[model samples]
Target: MRRVRQLAERTPADRERYVDLLRAVAITAVVLGHWTVAVVGYDAAGRPTGRSALPDLPWAYPLTWVAQVMPVFFVVGGFANAASLAARRARGGDAADWLLDRSARLVRPTTVLVLVLAAGALVARLAGVDPSTTRTVVWFATVPLWFLAAYLLVVPLTPLTYALHRRYGLAVPVVMAALVGLGDLARSTDHAGLALGNYLFGWLAVHQLGYVWYDARRKVGARFPPARGVGWTLLLGGLTVLVLLTTVGPYPVSMLNVPGEPLDNAAPPSLALLVLTITQLGLIMVLREPAERWLRRPGPWQAVIAVNAVVLTVFLWHLSAAILLVGGLDAVGLLPTPPVGSPAWLAWRVPWLLMLAVVLAALVAIFGPVEARAGRHRLPVKDAAPDGADRPSDARHQRHPLRAGLAVAGFVAVGAALVMNAVTPREAAEPLGLPVPALLAYLAGAGVLRVLRERPDTRGPTPPASPR
Candidate 1:
């Protein structure tokens, strides 16, 4: 608590604290939602199984309007990335340098999670544990990777997308939304493969909106968020379209992927998800003023900082924490099995959530240091001259062609591996209890990125200062 206070006190006066607040809220909602709604246990045949209770709780689908907070994350990501890239460029850094810095933060913690899961899966397989059971557990543990995969798909393109944002403003997201709609239409007609295109376009659309929000903050000053009317407009308009899509059109009302649903909103991201994102953005904007004010208080601000500090770790290992709890309880034959959505189940959630929270806290404490270390590894960015002259020296901005290619290849490999695992979990689980190939691909990519990040300046010996 003291450390959190000190960190909160150190926050820059000019910083947009609301963005951090939103990120904390988004991740918290995701964690709690997953823990509360998920059902994991051994079946009568003694086979492990897992599923979301949202399928049985039809009444809960509409609640997903607020619970599915991925859009909020992407929007906050956009704002943060736009700011980060701009700062990096201002400090004479190029896209590769920025990529190295930004991607490492994600890749490092993710690497830790993947390696741990892979090792556990391998050990389980070697112990003669049922391959199917191991695979199911691994799948459940790896659920968080899908979001990382989607975020990574759009992260490397920030430089390109931010440039487009500068030129086209709101039009960038408009075009992206149109593409998502098209993808949704194609998927409706059974052209499922064609809809895969939205894997990038849909998330990118929500992300681009963050760029818009960034610009709006700059224009309106940090004290305000666009206009209240703008928020209302987005809220009503997006909700209208979302209603039509789900009801009159063919989209599912649930933002989550309900089993047996022919058309779900989330897997590849449908038009409905995009609109839900818009609606969410609207609600966020509408509340930003009050939220920002509340966040200024020491208690809330410190909590936000504390959570953001290990947000990725919390996200990455939370499901695994649940898995650990379930496995332990099941081994003792003490796991609860009330029918999902029943009153008994609802009552059971209190203690279930409490136990899960304790386990997740322990997991976060153990692995959270890795995330902190990654943040510390960031290379210092040089500030501009006092006169504000450009100082993007060759050494600072340029990259060796080979290193550059390797960086691109690294990113592509990581992105492709994650997408494959996310989009095709069953296939990724073959030959091992884990997604070994994907893990290898991620490791290879992270290795290249790590090498690029740590290597000395490739420009070689600094020319001696010319005689003044």
Candidate 2:
């Protein structure tokens, strides 16, 4: 707590408080949204069955548009990654160095959770738990990795994408969004599943928009970052497009994946999702100044810093915490089995949220240091030699471009594998009973990235000279 407060106090006045605030809010909403929408019950055979209540609750569809904050995350990511890359590049850093620094924070928290999950799966299966039950529970627990996977894939490509943004300016996003639309069009035809490319294209487009945001801030005054009324335009325009697409087109209105739904707006990220994201980004931009002002208060700012300090850990472990709470409660008959959307079920949401929060809090306390270490890794050096200590030269620090490419390929494989496994779980057990191939991919890819971290100083990131 003291360290959190001290770190908050040291926050630069020029910092973009709104960015961190948005990130904190977005992830929190996702955790809460997941807890609220899931409806779990037991079948006639006494196996626990879990399903999303989205398709059943028609009124809940619109709520997803608001609740699905993945768009916001990508945008913020664009904003941050752009800043980080520029800073590193100015220091003569290469893509590999930038990727190493960015991904190191992700590595620690992710590894701890993945190992624990693999062990948990092994234990469950060895205890004679039904294969389906163990699979469902473990699958749900690791579902949070999807965001990490996607974000990891994007982080390494910032050099390439940001360059595209610089050369083509706004044309980049226009083309990217167009590709998403084409993918969606192809998805609607006999080749219903042909839009796989949009998964990368759609997210990269949203992320590119973040670069647009950052660039906008750089040109205009950061104090009033977004152009006036841009938010209004996006909100109205995106809302209209979303309505038209869902009603007149093949895309479903719900932003979340619905069980048994033929076409989800968010599965591969359709054109409609990009439109909705414009609305979200506009809303975020419009509120930037006000949010920044609110964040200036020490009380509020400290809370934001504290959350950001361990945000990755909180996000990665949230589902596992919920899974533990739900499964444990169910095993003891403490978990209620009310029909989803019933009055009783609605009433139970408060307690369910409270319990999930409690368990997640415990998880964060235990594993959050892994994430906290990442932030401190970027802090300026407090101690140095009298004559100013030297560090690795730019050339030595830069991984050979080809080697960097291979490293990136590894991370991309991890991310793509995660999305595949999460959407389509494998029923078979592994050598140690690790059920998901994505988990193995994630661990293996991370290992490759780490070994490639062969920088002169392997503690991780090179500390910024000014702590900027």
Candidate 3:
């Protein structure tokens, strides 16, 4: 037991290969999920409907298991934030500055993307295209922007959440779990308050698990090696929960299958999702070493890094690019209006999805450098010591497991608020154009990031510059 405890004390370094691999995988799943659902259709009045034509593919339902990969993203986010916060604190940096830097990184790239898309929509409208069509296209294309809005809101609150983690430890996960369970029950019973809470509490609960993992790693250290046994247990447990909920319980497994009313799992998230996160995290842990070795190869690792750098951009613009491809194809009379659930429709969708990716890549390639430059903020850097040995204060901040966990909770709260405001009766009924909610969300997120970035630095004693 003493040996095990000692091993646990030796925490691994910050750069965990498995986490990066998981992030890449998660992003790919998101892109493919969007592609699977990216069909172009016309409504009853022969106008374009925002539904995908390939909904009936045999593989579509099963894909949900892999397609609902957002939980992995949150898990990684928790880990990153936690490690970052811890590192910064050790370097005598304030929580505020750490929050500000992260918030800026997330918001800047996203804001540029939004402005460009909004401009394109405006230009299309002015060029005599059907205004309604243009509006719908823009709205559907920008759906992924919601993730950015949620992330920005959460990044600033990492310090508070991390504090909670430090105090409560595993109890944090237990409480979050109970909240999720209660929220699910409320949603099942049609209670508005409970339903709303479930939406915020349920997913946040899973995100908090990321903190749990980080803390456990810190505590268990080398003894808690990423092993196959842990991975299998988590995977089996998650699958069991998913089956129980979807089949025995009242919840639906198909997150995207909301038809009449919005699906419970589709919105705020459900208990089942929390299980999914566990399974994913476990699998990632088990594969950490091997995955890292594979990724070390220049060809694969470089691609992963490249994708990581522009992940937010790709997520935000992929849908828009899909809409553009469909519109262009339809305008040129090369493809017929897509029919929902038709095999022929599915065949065409493959190429359209590819076309969308190509066009999006082109746009990113052209404007990416400029967009990056515009978003860059100049931070003041200090010098190193004379012996070429850097002072402890000069070390780059490591992520705190606690801060990352808190950031997840913060994101969940902010995302829920934004979603509720946008979808509530009052907002829904307002005559504000379709794009208004999205525009407001983006602006609000940007505003929050700007505020966080401007907080006073409380870290004492700046280090001197090293001799050039």
Q: Each prediction's TM-score against the native?
A: 0.91, 0.90, 0.78
lDDT of 3: 0.58
Best by TM-score: 1
lDDT of each structure? 0.77, 0.75, 0.58
Ranking by lDDT: 1, 2, 3
Q: Which wins on lDDT, candidate 2 or candidate 3?
A: 2
Question: Which parts of model 3 have CA positions greater than 4 angstroms off?
Answer: 1-14, 52-59, 124-134, 216-225, 370-448, 451-468
Q: Candidate 3, residues 285-366: lDDT per residue as tens digits?
A: 6777687688656556555545555666677677766766766776877656556566777677677667777988976776
- Write one digit per residue (lDDT tens) for candidate 2, span 180-208: 98888887785756788887899999999
RMSD of 3: 8.4
Each model's total of backbone clashes: 0, 0, 23
For candidate 1, list the clashing residue pairs, or say none. Answer: none
lDDT (10s digit) by residue, model 1, range 374-421: 654121211112221223444554646566667777887887777666
Off by more than 4 A, model 2? 220-225, 377-399, 426-439, 454-468
lDDT of 3 at 181: 76
lDDT of 1 at 456: 34
Better of 1 and 3 by TM-score: 1
